[model samples]
Target chain A: MTLVLESQLPLLIVMLTLGTVAKVRTVGSGGEPGALSRLGPAVLVPGRMQAPALLVCAAGELVLAAGLLVSTHPFFRWGTVAFFAMSTYVLLELRRRRPDAGCGCFGEVSSAPVGWRSIGRTVALTGLAAVSVWSPVTGWAAAAGWVIAGPPPWYAAAGVALLALLSPEIEELIDRVRYRAPCEQRHGPAESVTLSKLRSSGTWRAHHQDLVSAEPYDSWRELCWRFFAFRNHEDDDVVFAVYLSGRRPAVRMAVVSREGSDSLPDYIPVSA
Target chain B: MGHPSVERRRVLAAAVLGRTGAVPGADPGDEEPLRAVVGEVLDVSPHLITIETPGGVQERLVIAPWATAWNGSDTTPGDLSVGSMVLMRTLRDGRVVERIWADTTRITGTILSITGKKDLTVELDCGPHRGHRSVVIPYRASGRLQVRHPQFEPGYLFDAIGIRRDGASLALLPATSQPPYPARSVPPPPPAYAGTLSRIAGTATWSDTFDEEERGAAYPMLERTDTGCPKTGVSCAGLPYLAVGSLLQVRNVCSNRSANVPVVACGCMAGRFCDRCVECDTSPRGRIAELSPSSYVELGGELIKGCFNAQIGLG
Candidate 1:
């Protein structure tokens, strides 16, 4: 029970810090539009209920943080478990729905995407809460007193908690450092006006459903190109290539028939 | 978000991305007559040189009669020999070599002084030449050079493209600014001023009116008023508080660049910006003002490089 209380002390501190950050960020700027927009798909929180839901979530975190600090009862431990479970569920759902959306789990400014690292952190916290629930409550109270009474020890514990909370961000930073390419090799121009115009065209809009999954062509050619893999109305998977040609910039579409198996032909002009 | 901290974080992220080369628009010319090829010289002659490209292909190129070659400072075709490394640019014809640099000395730096519009000096912070260098922009070359910003104020950084003329001098050449392809449509004017009229500190972005292709008339040009007097200022019909001809001061907080500009025309045309000013506002997210390309450049901002964090004050 003593060992369990000791371990849980650091976890509680980390959770308390994270909860405070989440609460402040949620209530910050009136509300975080980027986070709110992503909430609907991740948590089933509807657009109309986003404001109220955010308030409730933020307030709940604050209450939980305060409760954990003063009490060691089974109720608070169970509450920690429940809170961590909900967080893990939300993060997993976010990872599944919109892998590109920032977690907004820690703070509004953190643009880190929800990934296995976030899930792992949540799982670790939930495990700590579950373990602490089984331990006796008497030692937990004494440990909290020690953490508050001793300044040096409290500083050490706070440092450890901060490091634990920042572990995921550090991992992400390492990943970026390992995977990013050199500047000279990766630099390039922005999206061309021709591609922008093609995207805005009526024909492209009409077929946007099909072209949404298109991949841009990677070559330096006279024309800009993109390929789409989409299902037609008949539910048959069709592959086609779209080209933006001419100095004036015009669009031309070509369907690659499986039966024909012919290579790409010369540009077939299509009016915008 | 409305929070100033959030906006600052977003701007800081953009600045970091720009430094990492993650942001696009660094490439000056997507479409130009000159084609660059880097390779090792296998055989050399006065008129022709054979070299192997990195792609493992052997190619022969014709040397132009007036082709200028620079090894470190300046060199002639006679200096080229076997096993020499070179980066060469040739005309689209593939036969006429325009310029070749054996060891190029590129400079990215902040302008320290300007003698006039034709000759400005810069203090190089990056590249092999890491010191002050005088850049001579000839009158003929000025029209074609794609300077990131219009106003050559001290402390504005510029990525210079030219060959080394001497240890402390680089002869400036006109870098390409045209997009790979011409713009298909003219971008509509900026959006209506829906926000309140106050000292708004937000990101600043730029747009240009030097349309060599001549797609549309230059924006915010002077026009004769109904009262028969010449009027020049951005139209501000939608913004009743910020009336037309109102003077506004825009400052780039990051580079310490500032300019006092007048409202020539309203951001909105009939009712809205061409496309909500999405096409014109090149600044990062949470942009506040859209300056004319010249105005943006004059305020020490880059159109292609995207947005710079700025503070807009109503003067």
Candidate 2:
């Protein structure tokens, strides 16, 4: 029983360290505001005091985690138990006061609403911390022993399984991975890419010398091709239609005379 | 179904399959007949075609009866030589090809140097990864090309779509639109607003270039003389005088989520692209901010959708 209680110390220390780091990191304006401001005590705390309150909570958890890791003293162990008990109470209050807000237990990753799973996880954590209060091993000591030994006791595995089951963040992470933008919504190849393709065609090479200017004064897209118009030496409108797709898209050019006569330019076969 | 890793693997596998099996174009000019499958032609016939992917996989496709092939102009598939690179479009079933293009590629980037008089051999900086490619602009195309590309000097952007011949890209036709100035001489943005504009409404796009996880953004413009702006401002489109490391209060109108992100990079490319985002409604033209993927996702942006209707304020 004492060995199982000792095992709980390492788990409690890990949870506290993770929670503390997450809270501290997210208290900044640039970080995920939903991680702290939209959950936990932030829901109930005054607007001006929210960030400071989050920092204070994180500081308390850090101190308790450090104490639990280094010492097997009754003071540190009991402090962890009381911390988790208070967290459970806070989660319950969060659910009642702001049902839409999350527990915010794990920063932005924990933006799920307060529910039975969240409360149950806190209750289990409090129970685990309470059990550790009677143990004679520090979290570091127990962790070192587990590393040297083959594996942790079965109760440690049970604790991990229970916590994993209650973590709503897992589902959210999975949903993120599963999400894919619809085909039409996904970013298309940039205009630069299309322009690159237009420059690489045979028709451009054939009619290259006829244009008075290198820059197309006007360009527009219609269906599968983009049209570019430049003035020829004769002041004629040299218009080129470049197919937008294919390994070798069709490139065709016609010189529009000043009188609006569209005629294909003199075809000059080029060596490839 | 609830296993995180399992679900992730499944979704990733689906994404990969969707990419490999079929890719319909999403752009305005990317119609069904224009959808391309790029590979080296292994075998070609009036009825059947076989191509080898860059990955060495052999893809055997059926050629539609009315399919047309273009080498320089209209040509028969039988004329395309084996081992020649080709781009083809498929029918609805994605197995029957309707159009095939051959021996085409593009040369675009800053002109490093120009050599020769009758037929110029141009050295081009094709971005960072491609390094440099030597393109020869034939004497016939030089006059018109020179007219459109007035600077024609080093540091000017050169773009042309032409054919691959003799192990080099030939400059055939210029790109549809050209940036008038030299690559290094991007004009400064309009002068700073006369008065403080508290809330500027625009679009927010995302880029993974500068640390995907960093909570920062690339603003379109900053004061040209300011020490914080290392690059020349490309467009006179957005709020001016915003410098690097300045905090911006960005809010996504569609999601109603907001975040304060710092300016980390210059969004010169975004400035040049005068476009609107229709995420919720038509956003005003011009990209105000290009956010890191992390910041974008945190503010309820879908990475694949590309942009969001955004409003920003100085923080």
Give the range of the ten consecutive residues with the poorest summed lDDT in model 1 chain A: A217-226
What TM value does the first chain of each candidate achieve?
Answer: 0.50, 0.64
How does chain B score by TM in each prediction?
0.29, 0.52
List CA RMSD, all candidates.
23.3, 27.0
Worst 10 residues of 2 chain A by lDDT: A180-189
Q: Would candidate 2 be rated incorrect, acceptable, medium or high by CAPRI criteria? A: incorrect
Instruction: Superpose all Cα atoms of candidate 1 onto the true structure and report the RMSD in Å to 1 decimal.
Output: 23.3
How many clashing pairs in candidate 1? 15
**lDDT tens readout by residue for model 1, A6-50:** 456545655556755764665565432334554322245665676
**DockQ scores for all predicted structures:** 0.01, 0.01
**Candidate 2 structure quality by residue, lDDT tens digits, B171-279:** 7665423456556544333333334346878788765455422567877654333323334244534464344545667888987877777676666545544456888
Residue B241, model 1: Cα distance from true site in angstroms = 17
